[model samples]
Target: MSVFSRFFPQAQVSLVHCEENQVILTAKNDKTAESEKRQIRLIDLAREATPATCNLNPLLFNGHLQTGWTTIKETTEIPIYYKRKIFEQEIPALAGQFAVDFVVPAYPKTTDPEATDEARKYTLPSGLPARTTFFSKEELAALPSNDTKPMLVALHGLTGGSHEVYLRAALAPLVLDETAGWEACVVNGRGCAQMKLSTPLLFNARATWDVRQVIKWLRKTFPNRPLFGIGFSLGANILVNYLGEEGENCLLNAAVICANPWNLDVTNIALRSTWLGAEVYSAHMAVSLVNLFNQHVDELTHHPRLNVDDMKDVKYIHEFDRAVQCALWGYPTEGAYHRDASSTDSLLAIRIPFLAINAEDDPISVKQAIPYDEFKQTPYGVLLTTSWGGHLGWFELGGCRWFTKPAANFLNLIAKTIDLSVTPMPEKDKEGLYGETLANGSIHKPSHPSVFYPVNRKLSMTIDN
Candidate 1:
C-alpha cells in the first residue's frame, strides 16, 4: 500500500454505473472482506474528487429541484435534464435497461393480474382477434361523470402490455380530476398480455384495424366523449400509420407518440449494426420476440402457411418477421411488410394535432433515422427531440420520470383546440354543400380534397355561422 493510503486507510470506491447525475458505487476495504455498495449523487462525488472543478450548477444537476420543460427552442427543448452536459446524454440512454430492470423498486409496481383485476376486459370486434383493457369507472372516478372529458387510450410497444414499466410511468401523471382527469385504457395487440388469438393473425406496425375497432367501441360505449391516444415505440408507429390512413376521418382529437420508429427499414438496419446496436438492442428484442412466438408454437406449427422448421432457428428480428409474421400476414416477404409498415410514407396524411417526442441520443432509433423534413412538411405534427433520454428512459432523480407530465400537458392543450360539442351538419346540407368557413376564417370548398367529411352517415353536422 502507498504511504498515503496506509496513513488514511480509506476504502476504495469504484463506479458500477453512472446514469445522468446518479452514480452507483462499490466500495472495498483492505481491513474488511465484505464489500459495500450504494448509489450517490454524481455531483457530490465530483465535488469530493475536485471541488474547484466540480462546481455544478444546481439548476442543471439537482434532480429534485429540476422539474418542468426547458424550452431549448420554441416547442422543442431539452426535456428534464438530470445532467445538462452534451457528453453525458448517453448516460441516461444506456441506463434505460437498468431503470426497467429495477422498475418495481424504482417506481410503484403494477402487474398484469393487478391491472386485470381493476379493469374490464373486452375483446375488440375486428378481422383479427384483439383485446383492450378498460379501467373501471371506480378507478377513473376523478374524470368528469357526465362524459365531457376525453378518454386516453394508450398503446404499448413490442412485447409490452399494460403492466409494463414504461406504460405505468407514462400513466402516472393521470389522476382523478373533475375536468382535467382523463380515463385511460391499454389497447393490447393480438396474443399480447395472455390474450388468446382466435385467428392465426397478429399485429404489425402498419396494422390499424385493431386501433379502429378500439376507437369505434370507445365511441359507442361513451357517446359525446372525445378521444386522445398515446403510443410508444411499435405502438407509436401503428398510431401514426392509423392517423395517416384515416386522415380527417380519424376519431382521435390528438395524439402523443414517443420513440416511434417511423422508418422500419432504417430502424432495422440500425438495430443490426455493430456492438451496441446488434449485441445490445437487436439481440435483446430478437430474444423477446422469439420467446413470444415460442409461447404459441403449437398453434403456429399447425398453420399451413408457416414453416415450423424455419422458426426453430429464428435468431434475429428480421428472421422472425420473415418466418412467422410475414408468412402468416400473407406478405410476400419481410421487405414488403417493412416497406408497407413504415409510417414515414403516411406522415403527410395525418390531419389531427400530434406530438412526437424522441431522444437524439436514443441508441435503438438513431438521430439520423428521424424524418425531420417530413415533420416540417406536416402542418399538425410537432417533433420534440431531446438531446438525451435513452429509448423510453426519460428518468429523473428520485424515481421521477420526465415524459408523462409534458405528454399530458400536450394532450390537454390539443383537447382545448377541438370543440367536441359542435354537432355535425345535417345530411340534407351535404347535397347543397358549396363552401365551409373554419374556426381560423379559412373558407374550404367541398371540391377541396382536404375538407373534412363525416364518415358516419347518421351523424348530422352544421357549419359555424
Candidate 2:
C-alpha cells in the first residue's frame, strides 16, 4: 500500500519531505483509504487556508532562514537551526523503536482459577477484571543505587491501539527498560476494559480531569519518585492542556507530546472542510465517537442527534460536528464546545519543560497550528518538528531502527532531565550503523548498514533539581 494509503486513508500525500523545523506533507488524497490497509489515520491540512481571521501574535515578528524564503527572490535572516534534506536509504528498514523480543511466559496453571475471585476483583462489563501488570524496576534499581528513577506514564493516541498497549507491548520491555531505566506504568485511559471510562465521561475533554486523580494515587503510593508524562495526538492535546491549566503541581517533572493539534477550532473546521482534512480524517474521528455513543440507549434512538446509520453519508467534519453538537448539547454546530475545550489559547500560560513532537505532514497537527512565536520564546517549552511520521507516525528515517533508537533518545532526555546520568550502553563487539548498542553485546548486521540521519540539535538542556 502507498504510504498515504497505509497511514491516512482520507488524505492524499502530494509531497513528503524532511523539512528543517517539520515534515511537510501536502494533501493529494483526503478520502479514507480502505480499512484493511489502514495503519494510523491522522487529520489532514491544506497548503493554505481561509485567510486566518485570528490575529495570533500582536507582537508578530518572524525570523526566517534563507531556505524559509527559498525561490521567493528575497533574503531574510531568520536563523536555521538545522539543515533540511530528503533522504532515501537502501537497506531493510529495521528501526529501534519497533525492535522488541516479545516473550509471554506461560501463565503457570493457577492453583484455583475462579472468575469471581478476590484476586480478580476488578471486573469489566466484558467479564474481565481490572487486569494489571507489574513491570520490574530492575533497570531503574540498577540505574544508580543512590537515586530514584523517574516513572513514565505512556498514553496512546486515538485508535493507536491499547491505550497502554503501546507501552506494554513496545516501550516497556524493549526501549524504556534497557536504556532510560524508567518505571513504566501503562494505564488504559477510560473506555479501555481494565480501566474503563464511565460512559457519561468518554467523548469530551473533561474526561481528562481524572488523570490528576491517577497521578495523585501514583504519587501517594510511590512517594518521592519523579514522574514524567508522554502523550500522543488526542492524548497529547489532553496532557498539554492539563499541564497548562494545572502546571505540573504534584509529581510531574517533565512531559512530552507527539502530533498534537494545537488549534482545536481551526482543526475541527479543517477536518470538516480541507480536502483530505474532512473527507477521511474527520470521518474516522466522527465514526469512532458515534460508535462509542451508540451504546447509550438515550443517544442511540435520539433523532436530530446522530445514530451510527445517520452518519453513513457524513462526509465533512461540519456534518459530524453538527451531529456531536446535537448529541452533546442541544446545539447544531461546533461553536461553544470549541471555545471551551480547545488548548490553542492556553499555550502561552504553559510553564513546564514540554517537548512537543509534531510533523508538518500530520493532518491533525499543522505547521500553522503551532504557536511558534508563543512557544519558542517560552523558556520551558520547545517544539521538535520532524520530516515524517504520519500522525504518531514519526518513525526512524532511512533504514535505522526508527522506533527503538529515537524513542530511547527521547526517554533518555526525560531521565537525563532529572539529572540522572543514563548509563551508556555497554561495549558491543560491533555496533549498528545508527550506533545503537545491541542488547546481547552483539550487533546484527543486516545486508546493509541502517542509515538514519538524525536532525542534529545541540541539546543544551540542563536538569536543575
Candidate 3:
C-alpha cells in the first residue's frame, strides 16, 4: 500500500457494474421466493464508491431527518444566474398544445450590446411578465452553434421545477465555474414552478411524452453539442423511461438518475406501510398535487373523464393519481397507472451510459423499491447505493448536496470517453411505451401511443395490468 493509504486506509465499498450480456436471466417458472432471495443477494453485494461520500451534518443522519431537514434548510447562498426559455410542444392536450420551460444558466454576454448583470438577476422567470427579457424561441434559434462545451439537461422531483433549491444547488457549481466549460438547462414539468397548466393535465410518473418533445427541440436547436441528462426523483423516472423508449435513438450521450423510484407500485406500498411514510411524506405529496390541480381547475373541470369531485378527498398520492392522472392518461385503475408508469422495465432498454445513485436509507423512494437486478443486468448501467441519503437529501458539511460534484464528474467523463462525431439514430416509434395484443393477436393501438419495441429488437416485455 502507498504511504498515504497505509496512514489513513480508504473506506471500501462494492458496486454493481452491468456489462453487455451479463444478466442472470430469470426462468418463467421461478418461484416468487427465489426471486426475492436473488434481489436480497444483489442488495447485499452492491455498495457505493462515489467520490462524494455522504458525510451528512451530524444532526441529520437519520434518513427521515436528512430528507425532511434539507427541504427547509437555507441554501440560497449558492451563486448561480438563470434565465428562462419556453418550448411550445405540439403534443395532444387542451387547445391542441402543451408547453415546457427550461431554466438555463445566464452567462455574461460578450456579444449582446444590451446585456447587463441585472438581466441575469432572476434565477426563475416563470411568474414574470410575458414581456420580460427571457429568450424566446426565435432568439434562441438565432444563437451561434456551440459544439465546444457540453450541455447538461436536468429534471426536478415531484411537483418541483427550476425554482427548487435542491435543483439549483446541484447545478450551481458546474454552471457557475467558467473552467468547467459546462452549460445546463432544467426542464420544468408542466404546471410546475408557478407555470400554469394550459391543458387539463398535470405531469405524472409516466409523463415521458413531455420530456421527449423538449429533448427533440433541444437537439434540433443545439445540434452537435455533447448532451447529457441528469434527473432527480420523478424527473429521473421520466428520463429513464424516455431513454428506454428511445433506446439507441436516444439523443443524449449519457445520463444520471438520482433517487429514482424504479417501481411505483413498490413505492406506493412502502409509503402506506409506515405511519411516517403515509402521514408525512405521502400526505405532503398529496397536498402538492392538490394545489397544482387547483391551479388549473377552470380548464380541468371541463375534461370529460376527470372526476374533479373525487380529488376533494385525496389524502395520499395514489388517491390523487386515481382522481387525476388515471383519467388524463386513460388508465383504467390507479394500480395500472403505477404499474405502467414505473421505470423498472425501462432500465432493460437503455442504450447509453446510465449511472443511478440511490441511498439505502431513503424513506420516500425507499430502498426496497430500487430495481437492483434490473440495473445489475442493464448493459451500460451502474448502480451506486450509498449507505445513507434520504430521498434527494445528500447534504454535505456546508449544506451542498453530496451528489452534485459526482454527477458533474460522471457527465464529464462520459463526454471525454464517448465519440462525439456521430449522433445515435433514434427509434422511429413515436407513440408511447406500452401496447396491447388483442385476442385475435393483432396489436391494439391506443389513442396515445403506448407500446414500443425498440427499433427491430425488444429488450424486455412489459406486463399490462
Model 3 off-target regions past 4 Å?
A: 1-14, 19-49, 93-133, 136-138, 422-465
Give the TM-score of each candidate: 0.62, 0.55, 0.77
Per-residue lDDT, model 3, residue 130, is 26
Residue-level lDDT of model 2, residues 1-465, one tens digit each, is 888444432221122211222211122233645332222111111112111121111111111111122113112222111110111111122100110011123233234443235223332345432122221344223322334656666565553323223233335433334454556544344433332222322334322444554565556656656677777666677676566555323256656666677676767765656766665667666666555444443423533344555556655545655555445444444655554555554443343445566555566666667666655333445555544434543222221212223344544544553232211111222223322212111223356655421111122211111
**Colliding pairs, model 1:** 93-390, 142-176, 142-177, 424-460, 424-461, 424-462, 425-461, 425-462
At residue 128, give the lDDT of candidate 3. 37
Model 1 worst lDDT window (10 residues): 96-105
In Å, residue 370's CA in model 3 sits off its true spot by 0.7
Looking at model 3, the pairs that clash are 14-47, 249-425, 249-426, 432-449, 432-450, 433-450, 434-450, 434-451, 435-451
Pairwise lDDT winner, candidates 2 and 3: 3
Compute the lDDT for candidate 2.
Answer: 0.41
Order of models, best lDDT first: 3, 1, 2
Question: Candidate 3 on 29-111: residue-level lDDT in tens?
Answer: 23446435221111221222257244566567667878987768844555555555655555434222333334355454333
C-alpha RMSD for every candidate: 18.8, 21.2, 10.6
As a whole number from 0 to 100, the lDDT of residue 288 in candidate 3 is 86
- What does the lDDT read for residue 306 in candidate 1? 83
lDDT of 1: 0.54
By lDDT, the best candidate is 3
For candidate 3, the 10 contiguous residues with the lowest summed lDDT are: 39-48
Candidate scoring better on lDDT of 1 and 3 = 3
Per-candidate Cα lDDT values, in order, are 0.54, 0.41, 0.66
